[model samples]
Target: MSSPTTPVRRRCTLVAPGSDERKIAKALESAADEVVLDLEDAVTSARKDEARALVCRTIRELRTGRSISVRVNGLGTEWARDDLRTVGALDGVGIVLPKVDTADDLITADRLLAELGSTARLQALVETPQGVRSIDEICSATGRLEAVVIGYADLGAALGRVGGYTAERWLHVQDRILIAARAAGIQAIDGPHLSILDDAGFRAAAQWTRDLGFDGKWVIHPGQIDATTEIFTPTSAAVEHARRVLDAMAEAETTGAGAAQLDGHMLDEAVAVAARRVLAQTGG
Candidate 1:
């Protein structure tokens, strides 16, 4: 089993179909914080074998700065074992387990990876009703689990939610995912915004998720990368304010006070914690 470490920045996690070598090449050059070579929904059943071979080769040969992950087929499916066996042996690669509905799903995958003598991490893609409902357990399921991702399209379809993207429509599930991820101390990722041409809508969705404390978002198209990074990256003003909050609290601590005033608002240890988080997000 891979020892879990702090997840890399995933402000824009670009995914490419494993069957398409050209797309994979392009995604590697796109400079997204993370690149996912998808072998699950992105590949057709007939091409699963072909895609698997390509993904294995690509993962082995490629060299890039971004973190790499492979979205394996669901554990219930026939393809998942082969997918895990092939890629799980690749050291430092992240294994994205799609349609993960329970802690057992993760535990089973963990066992497989352990048997493979693999150093691969796990990312749970919670897309089904059961997955969302059992999210807390799933998040805390295994040490290999590094992140909890919302598979919005599949999740919405399973929940019978209709119409275009709306924050209100996913608020409850989103909040649940966030809370559970925080409890497990893992990264929370928002699913892809499928409307590739609707720049405005994409920006709005990224902003909403960023505000909700998602560490990053899945990006299906490279076009969405810039907006995603822009929205997720802390602003200069916000970083400055965070620094000020920390400075004020530190001064109060030196004076033997438990709190202080900053910009006419109370600043305490709790506020300093948030400030430090902001700086940490920006690597300040």
Candidate 2:
């Protein structure tokens, strides 16, 4: 798990193929809050070993300003153990476990990393039906777990859905994952919007997730990073309002009142908490 003292922020997480040096390099240069070096789905089976080796070396030599994570193969796959054995040993890196279906999966992964003396944090990629059903348990399974990411594409395929981007289509699962993540006190990340060329659709999806209280979203291309960040980050106006709310609450406290009026709206402890959250999100 991520250390409580040093929080991991993921307003935009860019996914790059572990086997593609060019793409990885480009991803490292992007302004994405985090970059995920993928060894699953993106890399072919024939190059799994090569990709794993490449990812290990990249993690060891990484000097990027953003956080780094590696999406390893699923727990059922033959390559997963070795991927964990190697990448899980790297300190400060995030280990993204895909197709996480149960609490046992996380418990097992935690044990493996513990055995390796790894300081890497774990992020659960919940894509399967079983995984969604077990989402709450998975979130609380291990202290190593840092984030719960909703993998909508694979989840849609698994659920036999054929549809375009529609908020109504994914609302249930999105809410389910978000509630579970909040309950577990971890980050909730929305999956990537697959239509990379549709800038409007991408922004819409990012905005929808942000409005739904997701901490961030995944971006498959470097081109999507800036938009995702912009969509998730607190705006200057919002930050200023939050600061005013906090100041009003502080003034009320000095006057020995439990509540205050800010811009004609009543502000109480609950409102103050929300204001503080807004400031914290922007590091204000």
Candidate 3:
């Protein structure tokens, strides 16, 4: 069995409105690797308590094999503490804290979960400039920290680039989140693409983030789940090449050689490590 710290294969995380049972049910049946029953942005202030109750009930009833996470309201909010206290004790349900600006936020949440006797993992949302700047500290804050999700919509608004993000405009911030999470040995997930109708644009964005080393992305709509999963998972050809690289390395090791030439390219320990990463991703 995988540990809580083990990086689960979360290629696509579908976000559903917590107050809407029908939508939440549909999301549970979707092809998403994970389903985030959202109680924050998806719920209005008037429906906050209702959404929390609905989300807790849905988590208790749903039996989807996919990972389930709840996007709770940020700290200092009227509903945040109750949200954690109520949903935090459920088995196999993780908490996603939005607008996490400091390490203390995660630390407090971690302690609260412990106090409630809940072992649910934590995923931090880096949405503001303060969150982005403090990502490294937040990621290293607690062992319950499983992933760091880049909230592009909020981040863009914070940075005054709300219309759309060009590669040159957002790459640095995106990479900063990626690097911070990776450095702390946690999953780094990219934010959602607001263009729900533009499949091509979505694919391009997913590919860009994948190349930047994000573990996965948030899917605001069910339509984006399949493509996101395909983009994040290792391709068959790449997996085959990775196996060959490992085989060649093993053969070279027997001969006391530190490196070898394979397919007209040099294969060394670094190449072997990358190949192993590919195999690991594929569960090979």
- Which candidate has the top score in TM-score? 2
Q: Clashing residue pairs, candidate 1?
A: none
Q: Rank the candidate models, highest TM-score first.
A: 2, 1, 3
Model 1 Cα RMSD, 1 decimal? 2.6
Taking the tens digit of each residue's C-alpha lDDT, what string does model 2 give over 130-232? 9999998988898888899989888999999886777668999999999888777788999998777538888988899899989899988777887888888
Candidate 2: C-alpha lDDT: 0.87
Looking at candidate 2, the ten consecutive residues that score lowest on lDDT are: 1-10
* Decoy 3 TM-score against native: 0.90
Identify the runs in model 2 with alpha carbons over 4 angstroms from their true place.
1-3, 248-269
lDDT of 2 at 35: 90
Per-model TM-score, in order, reads 0.90, 0.91, 0.90
Instruction: Go through the candidates in order and give the C-alpha RMSD of each one to the true structure.
Output: 2.6, 2.2, 2.7
Cα miss at 256, model 1 (Å)? 7.0
Count of backbone clashes for each model? 0, 1, 0
> Across residues 32-98, which tens digit of lDDT does each residue of candidate 1 receive?
8889999988899999999999988887788554589999999888999999999998767889999
Residues forming the 10-long window of minimal summed lDDT in candidate 3: 1-10
